[model samples]
Target: MLSAVYKSLKKIDTYLFIEQRDDFSKVPEPLLAMFGTAELVTVLNLSTKDRLGIADINKVRAELAEKGFYLQIPPPPENLLKEHLAKLKEQGKLSEKYNK
Candidate 1:
């Protein structure tokens, strides 16, 4: 299936994929307001792609077929401190002072 991809100007690394080019009829008004202006990134033939860079291809196809659009948002930022603490705990290197 052919899909049009658009990048949001207000959101970093956020994209909207629609089944048809220049069609936002299925998208919600509030979502569009928050997304700001959308710039067309590219048109893709999903049938030719085995996987996408971020989104799961099967999920994307399902959403597009059911909801007429698929929204791709950036993954949450990593918490370095939490990860370090977990690693330290796993390695038995976390001191009582550090825990406090």
Candidate 2:
């Protein structure tokens, strides 16, 4: 089965897959808001080998057939400690703004 792949404009590596282009409306409102506007990545035949980076082809197909959309969350950053430190640094700066 073929699938429509979309990338989230606001979030990195987040994707939404649907069976047809017209089926985008079937995606839930909360999901749409979280994903923001999705840019079309490609139309792919799911049976093809390695069509997806992380998600299982069978699970993707099952979700689409049952739920009309499949949400693909990004894998965690490779450097977990570094990401945590960066987030803490950012939050520290934001907190300073309020303290001033």
Candidate 3:
């Protein structure tokens, strides 16, 4: 991952706005991804937003620290079929000739 980051950086010929910071050896990959994806260096770098994200993650971590408390992944909503079929009807795609 570090190598890929370096290779991408070498390809770009401009100031990347990398800030000086302490060691981040203990940070998880998911959290690390946020560093690059959150536009912290470009858009808004308000410390409050980062604090909120960390607070949320800390709550999840605390829940997992419980004995035998497995995290549950909720399934996606399933009631959108009727709505999608309605859209298809409006588009005239629900007809047998159009479906073909």
TM-score of each: 0.93, 0.71, 0.21
Higher-ranked by lDDT: 2 or 3? 2
Please estimate how well model 1 matches the true structure, expressed as its whole-model Cα lDDT.
0.96
| TM-score of model 2 (CA atoms) | 0.71
Whole-model Cα lDDT per candidate?
A: 0.96, 0.83, 0.34
Q: TM-score for candidate 3, please give it.
A: 0.21
Q: Put down candidate 1 lDDT per residue, 1-100, tens digits, no spaces.
A: 9999999999999999999999999999999998999999999999999999999999999999999999999999999999999899889899987874
Of 1 and 3, the candidate ahead on TM-score is 1
Per-residue alpha-carbon lDDT of model 2 for 1-100, expressed as tens digits? 7888999999998999998974778888888998998899998887775646899877898998898889999777699866666787777743554433
Worst 10 residues of 1 by lDDT: 91-100
| Candidate 2 structure lDDT | 0.83
Give me the displacement of residue 48 in model 1, in angstroms. Answer: 1.3
**Could you give the candidate ranking by lDDT, starting with the highest?**
1, 2, 3
